[model samples]
Target: MTATAVQRFYRYHAYVYDFTRWTILRGRGQAVEQLKLRPDAQVLEVGCGTGLNFSQLLARLDPRRGWLTGLDFSEDMLARARRRVAAHGWSNVSLVCADAARMDLGRRFDGILFAYSLTMIPDWLAALERARTHLEPGGRMVVLDFGRFERWGPLGALARGWLRLNHVETRRPYVETMGSLFDRVEVHGRLGGYWFTAVGSNT
Candidate 1:
């Protein structure tokens, strides 16, 4: 999907994302655990729709010193995230309405995540490239997203088709792209290739 269609898709999905995504969007906790963030780490989540992953992320940081930034292209999604932050009284958290592929926040982060967000990007390679620039040296970037379902046999095709209808491209070489951009890359697939996590360490 193009950038405009992606924005439009989330404009409506933003309302129900928190209520409905638990069934399909998996591995958030495991992926966050893989990040291994420090108490004073600075965290950034690209394509952080509705801030669903913020609580898990914020829990890992030092409330007094650590900071979290949730960035998304959709204003509607960021609005929900803003409300979530306010309701939870999380002062260290901030939200940015910006394109993931072209964002320049003027500072690098200790941890960067793309939880089920990378595949939805049209220029996913550029998004990875941008995230790399935003990563601090010795930092880690973890990406958790839908995989190609290669282990599911015939059902894999059906699952990929369904995700494509929703604007997520499951067939892309996400792990390979990370290997090209990062110093060290580790990949893992879960639920028979239904989803995956790629951990890239910056050297």
Candidate 2:
């Protein structure tokens, strides 16, 4: 699928995303922990839908010293994030609507996160490369995404197929691509390959 198609997919999903995603999207808080953020760090979250992870991210950040930039391809999704940010009166959080694979914000971040967003990106390798360029040396990047259910037997295929119909491709070599880009990488899979987390540290 193309970037435009992905944006279209989120147009409607954005409305129901916050309410319905809890069923399948798990381990988000733990993934944010992998970032190991400092109170004054500059963080970037790619595809931060509805800003669902903002509370966890912001909890680790000092609004007076730290800042967050949330990027998404769909304005509909961003609109939801904007409301969430405004409702909480979070001044340090900002949202941008742009394609992850092609965005060049001309700056780097201390901690970069791709939570459940990487697998949905069509040019996922490009997105990872772009994210690497936007990461500071010694900074860390965290990827929490759907994993290939390597051991789930028939259920694995069913899960993968269902996710594909929703425009999320799980078979891509996402972890391998990150291994090639970062200085050091560690990966962990959860619940029989239901999801995975990759922490890439740039040395």
Candidate 3:
């Protein structure tokens, strides 16, 4: 999809996004926990829809010693996210409405996350590469999204079909592309084996 189309689609859905979809989604907290950030590390979350996972991340980082930044292409989404940040009274957080594929935060992050956001991006590979570029040395990128179901049976088809209906398309080439940039990649699945979480580190 073109950037305009993507932005429009998300803008229309931003308000109801969390309420409509949070139940089905899984692995976000696990992905955050696996980042293994030090107290002083800086973190960024691309496509931080509604900032649903911000509280989880905050628990892992000390406010006085750590910082967090969230970037998204949709202004509507950023607005809602900012509201959540304000309600939570967090001062160490920042939000930017920008294309993750071309964002220049002017500093590298100790960790980054792409939670349930890659499938919606038209140029996801470019965004992943940008995530790599934004990382400090030894930094890790934690990704959680729908994955191709390798299990056999009629249920797998049903699951894939359900995701397709929502405009979600999981790509397996992500592993190959990530392997080229990251020294180590670990992938795991959850939720009756339909969802996946991947952690890639610069090493």
TM-scores of the models, in the order given = 0.98, 0.98, 0.93
lDDT pick, better of 2 and 3: 2
Native-to-model Cα distance after best TM-score fit, residue 178 in candidate 1, in Å: 0.6
Could you tell me which 10 consecutive residues in candidate 1 have the lowest summed lDDT?
Answer: 10-19
Candidate 1: the clashing residue pairs are none
lDDT of 3 by residue, 1-203 (tens): 57777788777888798798777788777899889988888999999878988998888888999999989988988899999999989999999888977878788999999988887777888899888999998899988888777673787777777776566766447767777889999888775557888889975
What's the lDDT for candidate 1?
0.93
* Candidate 3: stretches off by over 4 Å: none
State each candidate's clash count. 0, 0, 0
- Candidate 2: where is the Cα deviation over 4 Å? none
Per-residue lDDT over 30-71 for candidate 2, one digit per residue giving the tens place of the 0 to 100 score: 999999999999999999989999999999999999999999
In model 2, pairs of residues that clash are none
**Using lDDT as the measure, which candidate wins?**
2
Model 3, TM vs. native: 0.93
